[model samples]
Target: MSLAVAGEEHEESGGRLKAIIFGGLDGILTSFAIIAGAHGANLGPVPMLALGISNVLADALSMGAGEFLSSRSYNSYVLKEREREMWELKNHPEGEIAEMVQLFVARGMSRVDAEVVIERMAKYEEFFVDIMMKEELSLPVPSEEDTLESLKDGIAMFLAFALFGMLPLACYILAGMLAPSLDVTSLFSVACVATAISLFALGAFKARFHDKRYLYAGVETVLLGGACAAVSYFVGRAVSQFAGFEQLEFVIQYEQQPTVL
Candidate 1:
């Protein structure tokens, strides 16, 4: 495989790109909110990192599983509709062909030409069913193994979420290890900068989906996502203040009292 998969396979694989971009976007925003909120809560590094890491894993799993189940449901619907089409072709050939003819004619195809076209198409049962599905039902006929394709999409979503979601947390881990003296506010600033850049780039990447200027898309993404994260931070701050949670400004040490259920 070429190292430039996105460039080389731009037209060939939209589904994978969609999973990667959207998943990455969701991951970044989600991680940013958790960190921002945790920071707002005045939690120590241990508690913040703990919250961020655990939430990332749990949410990533949910997103991945949700994507897989949705894809499976969609594939099941298409396959079931396909089987129904095949049955109609088998038992009600004339009616199905008539429907195809009407669709073609409604699109300004000459009646005689439409009849001739469908007549030839009807001779091939497989081709006939494919056309019927496309013209009559407006659904893509599944060509590959349905289960495998859905699984691939699901796995793509999972890996994307995990990889991208961990980015915000990675900043905290690296800073704690390398710059042990860095304060939480400064550390969070670094994370904010990194996340803003990532979100802008991802938004620009989305230019392929809609024919829009990359700058506009990038700004839109940053503004929208930043707004949401900001809300999370303020909410966390308000909740912490209202509840009078202890403020831990420690850099390394964390005190925890174990609870028994």
Candidate 2:
């Protein structure tokens, strides 16, 4: 029986889930950091919205491109190793067969059965290559239509990042549009709550694929994100104070004397 067949479905789903979790986590954390820092610096809604939107788009694109390149690199390396294995199989059949027999023996198959199994597998070149890729190279065989699949994974990451990453700024932007009279502190408080809920939900979603309890995972993720935001907030606060930036704001009033013009 081919071991790959048994786990192929599981691996595919797991890979996609991982991409979503990774992208979501990154998006929420980064945007929250920017929001926290802006709040600490006592910035207005316009600046916060500008910073948050800029980070979201730039970071999502960078992450998607990075994922695509990384997947492509891994695919290339696997192809090269597969080529090497095929060459060795053709030029040194005895050595390759011995390695296969050893692998089976180590799995508790008797030497006689191991040799018999390898001999039968060798009769089919495709099956022999599959075994060598799995056992010798310790790599899953690449899917035949993987290029499009990789692209989809990258797009998934970008979309997840953009959606989840906007949470920290969502409340601020909405409040600015809906209620200009709202205090900065009130707006920031709402943003904090939204970010916390998002962090917890993402953690729980990720935990479904692992052995950890969902509540524990949720709390852990929230704590991590909170800690990062807290650090960023304090740093921004300290920098702003040291630079005396708070005193730099100016409100200009035009006097009726301007009619002299």
Candidate 3:
């Protein structure tokens, strides 16, 4: 079956769902990695805190800007195409109606049904305009309100990531100070607990949007978070051992090179 039936509009809902999934998962995953690395290398609170703060701030601003630009560009393109559609309608109303008829006919409507629908729609220029915009173009133009909402979604993603991402680092920092004698393994255990809880909750939140079962979602998120954390931890350990440096300066400094992505 098709994703949507006729007279159904799921674009907005689907868009919102995707935003939540990607934003929450990315935040949990990326932050988990950083915290795992910091803890693995036995870096002091200073570098760990710096990395957490930088990752959150930089990612949030970047995501917000990216959303604003993409939404604005898409909106502009839709509006331009709309104007083009309007021009075509004005220049050749008959042709536009015929095309709409063909579109309806191709969708299982009989010729008579298609013509009747077209005739009824033509009576209201606005209705015809909407048909062409929605059905033919398949481009949903965002209103000013929609543009603001899109930006807000991006900001929400950033904040969500920041909050979840910092949990592991925060737990490590707090635990390390309170128990200075705690070993690296102990610290990692605590951080993992924090990571698991945060990722599970975020995954559940994401699942709510999809109307899916939470158990699977939670497990998926937890695994992804753990994976990211493990990779960073191993990489950090290798760097520290090979370089014979107690600090993570090399890894962080090397990351400063222009990201190829």
Top-TM-score candidate index: 2
Off by over 4 Å in 2: 1-15, 245-261
Over 4 Å off, model 1: 1-10, 13-15, 208-212, 245-261
Summed backbone clashes in each candidate are: 0, 0, 0
Sort all candidates by TM-score, best to worst.
2, 1, 3
TM per prediction: 0.83, 0.85, 0.79
On residues 1-261, what C-alpha lDDT tens digit does candidate 3 reach at each position?
669656965536555656566666666667667767876777865786788768966775676567667877888888888888888888899999999999999999999999998989887876677679999889765577987777777776666656666677788778889999997778778878987988898788777767678989889888877777788989987877866664467777888889786
Cand. 2 Cα-lDDT: 0.85
State each model's CA lDDT, in order.
0.85, 0.85, 0.77
Weakest lDDT window of 10 consecutive positions for candidate 1: 245-254
**Best lDDT among the predictions, by candidate number:** 2
Error of 3 at 136 (Å): 1.3
C-alpha RMSD between model 1 and the true structure: 8.1
Q: RMSD of candidate 2 to the true fold?
A: 6.4
